[model samples]
Target: MSNEIINIIADRPFNEAVQDKYFERVEAQLTEVFARPRLRSFAKSGGVLAGRAAETIDASVVGPSLVVFEERLSEDDKQDALDSQAFAEAVVNKLPAETSQEQRYMAYNEALSAIGWVTESYTYKKYDSKKLTLTMNDALLQVLETVISAGSGNVLSLVAAGFDKLKGDKEALKIVDAGSKESSVVSFKAVPCIVAPGGGMAMVMGGLDVFSKDYDGDFLFFTFKTEGVHLFQAAGIRKFNKRAFDRKRQQVYNYIDQFGDGLFKKIAG
Candidate 1:
């Protein structure tokens, strides 16, 4: 899936815009759901089910076995997670296990818990192939977006291209963190695309962020989310007729190039 984050900053009071209500409701709902004991427990299990794949290939071995780790979201004695409860009830009704409802629920819950993990942050480094790589998942970007949205200031998304991910040089961090500079081949732009009567647009476009780094074995490529700087309504052109299709699409690609270059300069410099 394309990794991107679109931020919306309304010129007028939020109450006057569609997303004002949507985000307000969602923020409230998230606050409530996130605070619930059951939901908190689920969140501790990485917010949702996840998986990983890393297998060794050998001619001698008939097949490769994947090492997988999964976490189970537990229900609080007094509170229940909507999704977890539904999943448990469905498994129980199917009679998959020859056990009581409670036992079945527990068993299925435990079983699914073994699927994988949801992470607040994670890092991947591999050096066996022609390229070395380091990548961060959407969860991390989401947090960054939250920080950016809550504040009213200039936020810079830096990309480090053609660098060493495994480098231990202490100064490397400072170099990448330097203030912004001008760029010709690359730039970053944010565009507002969708606006709803009540809800924020479902989709938004962001300037692409790109970076390349060196790993243990080879070169690594990194892509980060840079959704348009502002958020808008997400109505479709065919039905809702919000904006010109050509205009929106062009804005997206241009911003992507600009942002991509901005980040690239930081890394390459």
Candidate 2:
């Protein structure tokens, strides 16, 4: 006799309840991860501000298909991550609220590209404030100057003698006048811009355990446990931000949008 696949028990259908449970687990994991002292210290050292992670849930699929749940870093955290590593404060020129979303996104991309930075997964909410604030360490002034002189167009200038004068001046200087000529914006790429140790954990899914051989006639009962190591002081740095995860989620959304509900229905049914 062949073994039968057992379904997990839940108050609702297996598919619906499983998603809720998964998200609940994820939320608990994130809360624990953020509360760790080592992670908080690492973020503080990198000048990155800590913010709440917001969950984005998608349940458009019908039938037995898997649901998607995402926990993305807050916008404030993303902005802080970018500004923390910047060589100088970015001058932001605010655009009117009437400005079209496409126009704003395009403008921000163009401005960042002018400075040799490539952005990924640009969103309206990410740059909608129209204020790009980049604060760099005083020690990187020369490096900033080199980058500015090499490729930055009229968009960036260092006042009199470039960043050299601002090296020991102790006064903050704006490198890129994003609002001087035209409206521009700035943001970091969708990568692990913030580096920190013990910022990540590896999840392991255990084998399913059978709860009952027979339930409600044809239905069988079973459950599986997922485990992960919550390392507080591990070696090396990891990309603590969920930008990459967000990008993948966006790709899935795009696929679903392009293919329509029929595609999911076919797979689920």
Candidate 3:
């Protein structure tokens, strides 16, 4: 099934008919998955809170394709959703209409690589504040240590000063204390940092209270009332794109899982 779809997309002047067929195949697969009795029961019981289970499944299946689809949209068009046919057309529509075929091919390959990363490594989990503290502390310590090892003495001093301030700030202390006591709950999402060409991975920790200086890489942005953390890696920085956020956010309640401790250890060590 996958090979057939790949072959269809490999042709130059990408065929809309073939793309439609690909979407149909994906839709069919999702439909079957959602039809399972257990999933249906869960969905009916409000286990899937962000709209219907079908929509969640749709988003997860088509999410990767949007990486390619969105790159072609104009500012105005980006505000609207594109149908499968329209998306197919956009895939072949190189901006400026004069882009060389070689450049177009390179863009196509990059999109393919990005999509592969998401499909293969994206994950979701739910954790209590105690667990979250351990995870966040490890990640923060690693980042700080990395900077120190690089001999960025001035930056290290600045970051250490910031950390000291965070420890004293009443609001910051409240969150840290709450998380340390396991009184808070959190939803976590991790995916390959596709937006950043060389980034290892990006994480979003919903309900986790963190100071600005707590993170050292790229940048960290915040959102209010968001169901899950949305981190979109593009160019050299990570940003929030709610529309492309997790479709599996609701499933977090069903699982108690550890974040990428091994990955962190490997990088930190």
Candidate 4:
């Protein structure tokens, strides 16, 4: 059987949840300073960049504990997980009073809190008896997916670099095409763009998780652009700042930082 999965879209103005200007500034600076070297390294070494894995979830126990996984998920089996969360209740209650910008903010927060709650509570338990593996080509696709998911730099830069590498190598293309059959690909559709060298872009499908996790119990297929893939990271930070900062300068800084990290993490990851 397949492992269950849940999707969560976070609250807007995400930085506001942990409001600190200095934290914002430092984060931006770190991202900018690191981005170029990271991209160069990725290009030189191929696209298998490393990222600092987020604090690990204790998968060891969860991996084997079907009993525990079942018990934890019993309630979720019946309802839309967010519907039962306190955050969702609060957001719904606040909806009628959402007259001011601040109230709208609260509503947004409530929604995000609900999402986080569901994602954290939900678990994907991989049974040892149901083990799966990807071939080298499939493994490479998973690596591409991971780079896109955790990367902290510009989407265009990453996409451009990633593409350049892939296009230059027949081996990479073979891996990507074969891997796509075994897993859910980060589905990206083409979009028009004027800024990209090739005058086009691509968007990830099924959202970021397309790159964030393994798919089909075997391979993982990450999204990339033949041209405008770098925009993905930029777009993420831009979305965060659009709702987070009241100040325009702060918003701009956040965009740069967020975009930079997207690229940085990809190469570094």
The predictions' CA RMSDs to the true structure, in order, are: 22.6, 27.2, 19.0, 19.8
**Candidate 3 lDDT for residue 210:** 32
Tell how far residue 246 is off in model 4, in angstroms.
Answer: 7.3
Tens digit of per-residue lDDT, candidate 3, span 100-218: 33343334333332222122221111222212223432333333332122543433343333334443444433322332232122211111111222423321111122322333221
lDDT of candidates 1 onward, in order: 0.22, 0.23, 0.25, 0.26
For model 2, where is the 10-residue window of minimal lDDT?
Answer: 229-238
Worst 10-residue lDDT window for candidate 1 reads: 58-67
| Off by more than 4 A, model 4 | 12-17, 21-269
Off by over 4 Å in 1: 1-134, 138-140, 143-200, 204-212, 215-269
lDDT of 1 by residue, 1-269 (tens): 23322222222221223433323432443444323222221112322221211211100100000001111211221011222222222333334333432243233332112211011121111111112322322222222243233441222121111123212322333322221122111111121122223532211112222222211221112332333221111101101112322223222222222221212111111
Once fitted onto the true fold, the runs of candidate 3 whose alpha carbons sit more than 4 angstroms away are 1-139, 143-162, 182-242, 246-269
Q: Which candidate leads in TM-score?
A: 4
Highest lDDT scorer: 4
Please tell me which model should have the higher lDDT, number 3 or number 4: 4
lDDT of 3 at 124: 17
